[model samples]
Structures are given as structure tokens and as C-alpha cells.
Target: MDRDARLRKAVLWLKKKDPKLKRIIERVGPCTLTMMGRPYPVLLRAVISQQLSNKAAATMMDRVKEYYGNGKNFPDAKTLAGLSVVKLRKAGLSVAKSETLRRIANAYLDGSISDRKLSKLQDQEVLDLLCGIKGIGPWTAEMVLMFSLDRWDHFSLNDLILRKGIQRNYGIDENSKKEILEFTAGFSPYRTIVCWYLWRDHAAGI
Candidate 1:
């Protein structure tokens, strides 16, 4: 139940579930993936990163943070909610993303989305709650679950990098959603670890 124990358990489970993943684990060595920052800031970053490269997203986020608050401190929900849409746009957000950021900030201010509340919800429940917000879809919800909530069982089947990693590593041709889900089911309760490895594989150009 400690961090190291949980990571070890995940690796062992993943190695037992799939040979390809076992090889990946051997190559990757350890699970160092972790969540960073508070939920509000993480969610804000997620919103800003939508449909943009990581560098672009980070640059915009830095500007947005500096415009609203000191760059070292992420703006709280109340602060973000009070900002004008025009001001958010000046930070390089698209109109839609700016609106989404406002909605997320409002949700936090209204107690609709909170770390305490989300911590008590199941993965699917968290997804349902978050996806109900405007401009937050399944992928975004899953990102929150994995990166903000630190839910070990979460996976993003719609992620292109994950799909490519699976296909390339497992030596399969194009796979359907059903196939991917079924295949990944073997990694149940530790699919987040699986995703991390898949992402690493993609990043390594494997």
C-alpha cells in the first residue's frame, strides 16, 4: 500500500498479463510516472494543452499564469473565474478552450469539482462527473483521473500514441476499440502502468 509496493505490484501484474508488456517493463526498468500540482492547476494545464503540442501548451500556460498571477503560483479557481474571456484569449487560448477553462474554474468555485469529492468517486464516476462539463470529454476526463487523481486503473483507449504502441509492440495490424479494450483488460487494476509503458515506447520511437 506504500508507493513503492504499489508500483512493484503493478509491474508484477503487468508482466504476468502480457509478454510484450513484460519485455517493455524489463526495458523500461521502473515506474516513475507520477502526478504533479493540485487538481485545479492540473486541470487548467489539461484544458490549455488540448489540441496543441506540449511545448506550445506549456508556453501558453506560462503566459496565462503570469497574466493572472505570479508565474510560480497557479491561479486559484476564484481568481480564474473572475478573469474576462478576452484576457484569457490574450494568453493565447482559443475561444473554445478559454470558455472551457472558465467552466472548469466555475465548477471548482461552485463545489462541483473538488479533490475531496473526486477522491471518493470511482474511476467511471469521476469520468461521468467531469465529462458532463462543457468541452471536457472522455479523454480529458481520463487524463485528469490518471495525471491528477493518480488512479492506477485508468487508461485512455482513444489515445493515438497508446494505440500505436500496442500495435507495434504486440505485432498486430490495425485493431478495433473492442480488441484494444479486451487486450488491455488483462492489465486491469494496473492499466495506468501499461499506459505509461506504451507512452514510453512511443516516445522512444519503438
Candidate 2:
């Protein structure tokens, strides 16, 4: 099956298999489930989304899109490398975000990494490899893995909503790695999707 279809199946299975998940699933409904474009652009978008509100990210992404290569479409590593950081910063990206995008582009063009390799890697492996690059960190790397690579087996423990959701829903005492992993284990292969719902739920105050 294709990735989107598989994701649909995964989300459905999560809701059906676990009644607790069903509550959020019913209210939040299905997610976008669409991840388009090549690896670098998607990763850039992931980086752009980091530590920023959705509105701010959307505005910055629009500015990036205004560039010849929309970060979503033609985020060619070579092209991005040649682009001006000052221009990108004027486009509304923070200094760190511009640097991160450059690092991602360099990693891709320098034969240090590729989408195929990222796809094959375990989540932890992907995290370590990407995080080794300047400006790439665990949370941003997880976003790249979860959204771009569409690795079903991902859990963004760094996400605050997921941690709070677990505490609220499952009554987990702490959001440690062990507790979070154990609580979210049942959502396997779709924990990121569950995280999305929890974030949405938290936003809606439901």
C-alpha cells in the first residue's frame, strides 16, 4: 500500500484498538496525511516549523516560497547553498533557522545523507545522524522523520502536548522517556499521529 493509505490504516487501527485513542480520533478526526515534495524541502519545512507558532511558520514558509525555489518544492541542495542567508533572514527566518536550512542543504549535497538512507534508518539512528549536523536537533529531526519520511514508527516525546495529554488521559505520573514510551507503545507506528491529535485536542481545550 501507498504511504497515505497505510497511514490511514494505521490511524484507524489506533482508534479501534485503543478506546482511549478513539476519543481524540473522533473529535480531532483524520489529519492531513499528505507529505509532498522531496526530502530537503520537507526537512526545511520541518525546521521552519520548529519553536514557532503555526501562524508564524506559515508566514515564513510563504516568504520562503516567494524565493525562486519554494522550500516545499525546489529546495535543491545546490540552489539553497548558493542562496543568501541575509536574504533568507529578511524573508523572516531567524538566524538559527537560516543556518539550519543551510546545514540541511549542505548535508544533502555533500553526500553525507540522502532520503533513501533516512528512510531505511531506525528512528533513533535518523535522530543521531541528523542531529550531528549543525542546527539539527532531536525535535526537528523527529519532525522530519515523522512528516517527510512518513516513518510510522515515530514518537515525538519532545512534544509538550503529547506529554500533557498522556498525563491527562493516561494519568502517567511523569513524562520521562520510559513512561512516555510505555504509555504510547500501544500506538506504535502511529504515535506521531496520536501526538498530532493530542496537540489539536490541547489547542481546542477538549
Candidate 3:
């Protein structure tokens, strides 16, 4: 099946498995979740987004891209890896985030990580590989797995928005991680897709 077909199949499977999710799918329309880019740039953007608001992250990314890519293209791993932390800091990145981006670019350049290599690895292996990087944790790795690797089963439990969405939609206490895990497990293998709908539902105030 194609990517859209796979997403449709996952949606149908989730709808049949859970009534809540079925309603969520109906209201949310379609799963718009998709891989945004290759592993290096995807992870690069993820690092830049950490601990910041979406608007802030996007603005900073524009600044960084303008500085390095003349405001058009996102720089490649070599270009990013060659940039000093000071230059990146000047481009609106914190010193720590600048260092992380450089390390990620270096990881891609040095063959420590790559799209081809990551595609061959399982979810846990990918998590292990990425989380070994100094600034990346499970949340960032999970985002890479979901968006970059297109691993539909992975969910970022650490995401506050997702947790709040579960609370509001499922009536599960946001503080009760185990209950949320159990409730979400019913959507297994498509939890990420279901979570996409849940996010939409929360955003819609339904």
C-alpha cells in the first residue's frame, strides 16, 4: 500500500477497535500526520523546537535558515555541522540547542546515524540510537520515529498536549500515566494515528 493508503488502513483499524476513536476520526476528518522531511533535517528541526512554543520555534527556524540557506533551503548536514555554535546562537538558537544541532549534524555526517541505517532498525533500536545523543531524549526520538521514520506505533508519552488531550477526551486523569497507557494500548499499532485524531479533537474542543 502507499503512504496515504497505509494511513487510511490504520484509521479504519482504529475506528473499528474503539468507539471513542471512531468518533474522533469522524470529527477530525482525516489523519494529516505525515513525515515532514529526511532524518537529518527532521531531527534538526526537532532539536530546535525543544522547550519552545511552536510560533517561537518556527520563527527561530526561519532565522536560522535565512542565516545559512539564504532564507530558502534548509541547510544540509555538512553545512549545519560546519557552522560554529556561536554562529547558530547568533541565528536565534540557544547555545545548548546550537550544540545539539551541530552534534546531530555530525552524527549524520560521521555515519553514526542515517535514514538508510535507521530504516533498517526497529523502534526501540532507533530510540536507543537517538537517545544516546546528548541533547535528545525519548520524546525527541519518538517524534523522529513517528514523523521521520513513519513508525505509526510510536507515541510520545512525554508530550503534555497529548496527555491533556487524553484527559479531556477519554476522561482519563492526565496525572495517571498507567491508566492512559492502558486506555491507549487498545489502539495498539495505530496509537500514533489515534493520537493524531485525539490532538485534533482537543484542538476542536470536542
Candidate 4:
């Protein structure tokens, strides 16, 4: 099926899974999630976005593009790997992040982590491969699965904002991690859509 049809189907499945999610869907309306499609750029953006606000990440990425991308396209792995750590740091990356970026570049160049290979792997396999890279963890891997690979079932259980959104929507003081996962399990293959609404509700202060 097409993208819009798939999203609509996901929405319907979510609405059936939980009435709370149904309300959230009514409140939030359509999904606004966008996929960037390229593994290298998407993973690079995810790295830059760590612990930073969206605007800050955008600014930093623009600087990176300007410095290494000839002020136009995103730099390829070979180009980024060739740049000095000092130059990468000047583009607003922390030393660790600079190192991580170079490592990611090297991984891409060495055939350890390519878009083609990742696309053929299952979600858990992909996570294991990505998390093996220094500085990439479960959350980052899930972000790549959802936003880069467009996997519809991925959910970020470690996200504090998602937990808070769940608590607020369910009128609970606290929920165990297991409970949250169990509750969300009802959504199954459409859990990504559920996460989108939860994030939307959190952002809207609902």
C-alpha cells in the first residue's frame, strides 16, 4: 500500500487498541512524522540532536554543512572522515560527538553500517549493529528505525517525555516500565503512530 494509506490504517489500528489513544488522535489529528530516507544524514542528524533543542541542532547542522558540505549538500562519509577533529569541533560538536561522527563515517566506508545492509536486517539486528558503534545507544537506534528507515512498529521506551505523556493521559501517578510496554504492546505494528500522538500530546501540554 501507499504511505498515506498505511498511515491511515495505522491510525485506525491505534484507535482500536486504546480509547486514550483515540482521544489523543482526535486532539492531535494527522501524523506529522517525516522520514529523511538517507541513513548517513539521518544518523548524523540524530547524533547532532542528542541533548540539544531542535533549533540548536538545526543551527549546528547548518554550520556542519557550511564547513564540510561546501555550503550545499551534506558531506559524504569519505569527506567527513577526512576532516580533522578540530574542524568538526569548530562546527559546534563536542569532542566525543566529533569522535562519534568520525567513527560513523569510518563504519559507513568500511561496509559495517551501510543503508543497504541495514535495510535488509530486522529491527533488533539493526539495533544491535548500530548500538555497537561508540556513542549510539538504544534511543538513537530507535530514532533511526522510525525516522530513517520508516519502521512503523518502533517505540522509544526510554524516552522520559513518552512516559510522562502516558501517565498524564492515563491519569496515573506513576507507571512501571513493564506496565508501559505492556500497555503499548496492544498497539503492535502501529506503535509508532501511538508514539507520535503521545509526543504530540506532550508537546501540546495536553
Candidate 5:
């Protein structure tokens, strides 16, 4: 299918999956499903952005951008591999995260990873490959799959806001992890967008 067709399908899927989400469309602006491109480093930057406020991530990314002199060309595996751990730590990355970056860079440099290979991988597979780096986990992997890959259907039931929203909506005081997982199954293929509205509603107190 063409881009327009795919986008139309995504819109229709999102609309049909949840009426609350349709209300979100009528109120707050469109969901910012911007693609920050496909590089691991780019997605890693986004992972760093997650949980923390956007302003904080921008500051850290600025440091990295300054180090590289330009954002147009992504610093490849070789470039990242050459960075000293101390320097990256000084740039506002946790020691573990810096190390994860190094491991991923090394994997890329050694030809164990390639863009071609990533295209064929599923979310769980990509998560498995990436989480080998230590700092990267399920949440971080989900963010990469959703944003950088432009995955139209993805969500993190493990995410606190979404979990809270689900519990609140269902009027449950608490639920086992298994119950939560079972509940979110209905949002499959659109769970990502469902989570978006969940967060938005929480923010708006609506």
C-alpha cells in the first residue's frame, strides 16, 4: 500500500478501536507521531527522552549534537565506539546507559547489526536484540519500535500512566499483571494509540 493508504488505514483503525481516542482528536491537537528517523542512536536519544521531560532530553541531545557538529549526518557506530565512557557520562547519560550505547555501537561496528536486518524483525525480536546492551529494557525497546520505526500499532501496558488509566477506567482498585495484560489485549494493533489517549486524558484530568 502507498503512504496515503497506510495513513488512512491507521486513522480508521485508531478511530474504531476507541471512542475516547476519537474524543481526544476533537479536543487536544493531533498526536505527535513524528518520525525521528531509523538510526539506533536516534532511537536511543528518544529512549533517553522518555519518562523524563522533553526539555531535559533536548539539553542532552544538544550536547551530543554539538560534539558531532551537525545533526544532518548521524554519528555512526565508529563514531560512537570512539567515545570515552567518561565523556558520555559527563554529557548527562547514566553510566549504564552510556555502556549500553557502547555495546550497541560495537555490535553495529562488528557487522552483527544492520538496518536491513532490523526491517524484518518483530517488536519482541528487536527488544531482545537491543536489550542485550543492558540498559535498554522493554520500555525503551517499545519506544524505539513505536517512534523510530513508525510502528502504527504499539503500546506499553507496562507504562505507569496506561496502567493507571486502565485500572481507573475499569474501576478496579488493583489488578494482577496478568489481568492487566489480558485487558489490554483488546487494544491490540492499536494499543500504542490507546496509550496515547490514556496519557492525554490523565494530563487533562478529563
Candidate 6:
């Protein structure tokens, strides 16, 4: 099925599977989960976003792009790979993040990672490949799968906000991984859409 049809089906399935999540769906309105952009740039921004507020991450990303390329366009892998870690730090990236960006850029530039290849891989394969990079952990890999590759099955248990959202909405303790998994098991294959609603609900303090 096409993306919209699949999302619609996913939403209906979710509404049937979980009443609480159905409430979230109703409160949050439509599932607007979407592929954000190309793998490289999306992954690049994900790396920049770690441990930072959304506003801070966006500001830093814009600064990095402006410093390395045109203010409006994200830099290519060659441009990123060519940048020194120190230069990237000057653009407001932390040292570790700068190093990570360089490693990611090098991974793309050297053909170790490719958007086209990633598009064809199974979810686990994609996660394994991406998480193999030194600084790319499971959470980041999961975000890339959901946002960049348009995969809908991923739900990052590592996301603290998501954990909080679950706790707030479902009254489950955030630290209970097993419980969380069991509670959300029915959301599989459409977990990304469920996640989008949870995020929206959390953002709206619902």
C-alpha cells in the first residue's frame, strides 16, 4: 500500500488495539508522521540533536550549515568530511558531536553507508549498520529509521520523553522496560504512528 493508506490502516488498527492510544489519536488529530529528508542530512541533524533542546539543536544545525555551506542548504558529505572537528566546534557543536559528524560524514563518503543501501535493508540490518558507527547509538539509529527511511515499525524505548509520555498517558512506570514493551506490543508495525501521537500529546501536555 501507499504511505497514506498504510498510515490510515495503522491508525485504525491502533485505535482498535489500544483504547488509551486511541484517545491520544483523537486528541492529537491526524497522524502526520512523515519522512523528514535524505538519510545523510537527517542522520546528521539527529547526531546534532542529542542531549540538546529542540531549539538549541535547530540553532546549532543552522549555524553548522551556515558555517560550512550556504545558510539555507545542508552541506554534502564531502564538505562535512573535509571539516576539522575544531572547525565544527566553532559552529556550536560539542567536541563529541563534531567528531561524530565527521565519522558519519566519512562513513557516507567512503561508501560504508549509503541512503540507497539503507532503503533496501531490513529494519534490524539498518539498525545494525547504523549503530555500528562509533557514536551512532540505538536511539539515533531508530530515529533515522522512522524519520529518514520512513519505516513505521520503530519505537525508541531509549527516548526519555517517550517514556514520560507513556508513563503520563498509561500510568506505567517509565523505568519498567518489560512492562512498557508488553503494553506497547500491539502497536507494532504502526509504533511510529503511535509514537507521533504520543509525542504530540506530550507536547500539548494532554
lDDT for each candidate structure = 0.84, 0.79, 0.85, 0.85, 0.70, 0.88
Query: For residues 50-102, could you state the per-residue lDDT of candidate 4 as single tens digits?
Result: 98998999999999999899786668999999988899999999998899899
Q: How high is the lDDT of residue 80 in model 3?
A: 89
lDDT of 1 at 122: 92
What is the C-alpha lDDT profile of model 1 across 1-206, one tens digit per residue? 89989799879878887787888888877888889756677778887888889999989989987889788766788988898889999999998998998899899989998988988899899989998999988888888889888989866987878887878877554357778888778778888889998888667665
- Report the lDDT tens digits of candidate 2 across residue range 71-142: 445447887777778978987888888888888888888888898888888878889998898888788788
Question: Which whole-number lDDT from 0 to 100 does residue 180 have in model 1?
Answer: 80
- Residue 110, candidate 1: C-alpha displacement in angstroms: 1.4
**What's the TM for model 6?**
0.96
Find the candidate with the highest TM-score and give its number: 6
Q: How far is 185's C-alpha from truth in model 1 (Å)?
A: 0.6
What's model 1's lDDT at 105?
86
**Cα-based TM-score, every candidate:** 0.94, 0.84, 0.93, 0.94, 0.82, 0.96
Q: Candidate 3 at residue 12, lDDT?
A: 86
Candidate 5 similarity to native, TM-score: 0.82
lDDT of 6: 0.88
Measured with C-alpha atoms, the lDDT of residue 95 in candidate 1 is 89
Question: Sorted by lDDT, highest first, which candidate order results?
Answer: 6, 4, 3, 1, 2, 5
Q: Please provide, for model 6 over 23-108, each residue's C-alpha lDDT reduced to its tens digit, 9 standing for 90 to 100.
A: 88899887888788988888988999998999999999999878887897678889988999889989899889999999998999
Model 3 stretches with alpha carbons more than 4 Å out: none
Q: Residue by residue across 56-75, what tens digits does model 3's lDDT show?
A: 99999998889997686668
Error of 2 at 48 (Å): 1.5
Better of 3 and 6 by lDDT: 6
